[model samples]
Target: MAELVRRAGLPVSAEEAFAWHERPGAVERLLPPSAGIQVAQCSGTIRDGDRVKLQVSFGGVKVPWVLEYYGYEPGRRFCERQIEGVFARWSHERRFEPDGPDACFLEDRIDFQMPGLWPIRSWAERRILRGLEKTLRYRHDTVAADLAEHARWRDRPRLRIAVTGSSGLIGSALVPFLTTGGHSVQRLVRGRSGEHEGHVVWDPETGQLQADRLQPLDAVIHLAGENLAAGRWTAERKERIRASRVEATRRLCQSLARLLRPPRVLVVASAIGYYGDRGDELLDETSRPGRGFLADLCRDWEAASRPARSAGIRVVVARFGLVLSPRGGSLAKMLTPFRFGLGGRLGGGGQFWSWISLDDVLGALLHAIMTDELEGPVNFVAPEPVTNAQFTRTLARVLRRPAVLPVPAWALRIALGEMAREMVLPSARVVPRKLEQTGYPFRHRKLEWPLRHLLGRQTPE
Candidate 1:
């Protein structure tokens, strides 16, 4: 059998570090985005005989891996062995060794034998080891970041929160984040009462929800809305977007206000589009809304929270810039063309595009719910915004691709019509003023490293 062992120093106690792994979201948080590893079945917590199932998808192929846990010693070590998978024989042991009350070490030891004859097995082993280094580094970094953030809020009480659009990009990540942090999450799915299965029932379209269910919640995060870039700006599409944010939010908030005991905090997702095309202007929460379909919608969107606000709910309006992750959002859309070396700036490449990694977005949301001081509009973008040209160049550098194909304004306008002018070519330089003031620990403070980390392109450091 071949062996691969890796170890990372943890800043927390061995027990503390072990608990983080024992939680429900360890697999989700640890897996690299580019790897496309899907959880067929997740056995939450480190327990004897618990089984975890995974399918690795690459180049349009799915290879299943089943792991059954054994040596489950809490605060010390846990072992998992492959029962069914690609490798001929495999065993993994995750051991947490204590250094002191404040420090520990996570040792990941793997023993496995590759399938096939000597030459083929040797080549496969070499390839796997090369890729494994990057993945392990990412896991170590993620664990460290998460530990730091949780440490900051260590004294705070755990909360029971309800989230709308739980299946959406942000909500999906946020749920696991909160759950792993020891907070209970009740997903607010828009389905009939009995159909909820276990989720909280709520339908903004019909304004139906059981107020009693929300009475015990500590916070509510509303993220349900039609996707802005889903299609061209047709009249019908515009109405759906407007109604989804304005009407849906208004109805939901009204329901919350009427609750016997409403949640203390309510976080509503807004967009940097609320700032409109400001033409190189550095915008913040205090900045007035600019003129546009988006800005107008945002005005009404925030106003819809009046019911909740008037009822003493701490309302935090998170005005998000482009969220970067290969899993979804604008970054996902850009990946295909960019990977093929066709990425380039739009128009003059002068317009600023403020953005944040998916990690920061989730961090900001968690901070919002936890920090009582954060209220009203808060820009949730990286402190330093970049021009379209700078972003293109950085992205190309990360992917090791040359970006020579710049999409001209006239062509974009012709192809995308109104969307090309409003979204494709607009600029808004935004910064997270409230998060900065409140000392929200940003996991990704810059772009290049975050991009590299998310895409599993980390260079030796």
Candidate 2:
């Protein structure tokens, strides 16, 4: 049998650390996002006593395993051991210590042997251990980042920030960002009461957020709305989409208005679709709303925040562009077809696609929050805009594929109904002039670089 150990330092109280250590789903959230573990079932009353049963997937194969928690304690320590698993043997321990009067530290030590007792040789085992160590280092860094964010929140004036659509694509990413940034984040979950991790229960359909929930606050970032490009925009579907954003915004803004201590700032989510299909036209924050379902919905969505503004809250409307993420989003989805040598330019490749990396979008939102000068409409798009053809070429090049096919406009229109013609074919050459003018620097400024980075093609030297 072979052995390895990894550890992390966390800035938290032994008690607070214990709570997290004991909390259900805590370890699952902390598990590396890249780990392909299926049926990750954790059960038992104790953190160290819980058995974790999972099938680890590697190289198109699944290895089943079971672990048992052996050591148990409330705040200081806990440990786990492999009962029966693919590993020859495995053991881990968690230790919490007081770093200072206000700061605490957590250490994680894991020792394991992989691909158990075969002719797999010592060299391969060492290499695998090295890789495992690298992954553990990443987990430690992530934990440190989380701890630092929580520290910032503890040090700042407590602000109650309630968020809607907290489980959606943007929300899922943004909530973690906000919480780690030291601001108290409460999700407006559907049905339930009393805040947990600053989460508040609110039914957008029913217009219900416990009035007291919004009483204390510093700012509001309204990102709740139906996804525009999820499905075909039938007239009935369009109504549901439009009503979801408008009604939810109206209800939340009204609720904030009723609060004794309303948030000082209201940063609401809008979309670049407000510009519609203005062929070859450059649109900034001041562009007029175009004529379309999305255009009308965005216009109304921003207007829904008026009640909060009228109630003396500083309001900023974020007219967002296409937000790209590595795990999910249009870019990731497009990678599949391109990787298989099937990706091609869409609809003559003439339409302009103005987009922002999800990182930049979140950064811009945080910038808007910190910078009091930012108000009114802010375009959350990258500084550079690329044509559809350029996008196709860049993506294909990144995947080492040939972009020889240009999907006809009629074909797309037939497949996607009005959506293809409107969403996929429109050209809004948007620029983040306002954000740039405010001294906000984009981490990802170009399409090719971000795409490459997202696709894991740009290896480190």
Which candidate leads the pack in lDDT? 1
Off by over 4 Å in 1: 192-198, 212-215
lDDT digits (tens) for residues 273-354 of candidate 1: 8888998877888988887888888888988999999999999998989899898887898889999998998888989989
C-alpha RMSD between model 1 and the true structure: 1.6
Instruction: Supply the global lDDT for candidate 2.
Output: 0.74
lDDT of 2 by residue, 130-183 (tens): 756655665555556545444533645645566777677677767656654445
Top model number, TM-score: 1
Once fitted onto the true fold, the runs of candidate 2 whose alpha carbons sit more than 4 angstroms away are 1-112, 117-159, 194-197, 213-215
Local distance difference test scores for all models: 0.87, 0.74
All candidates: TM-score: 0.96, 0.76
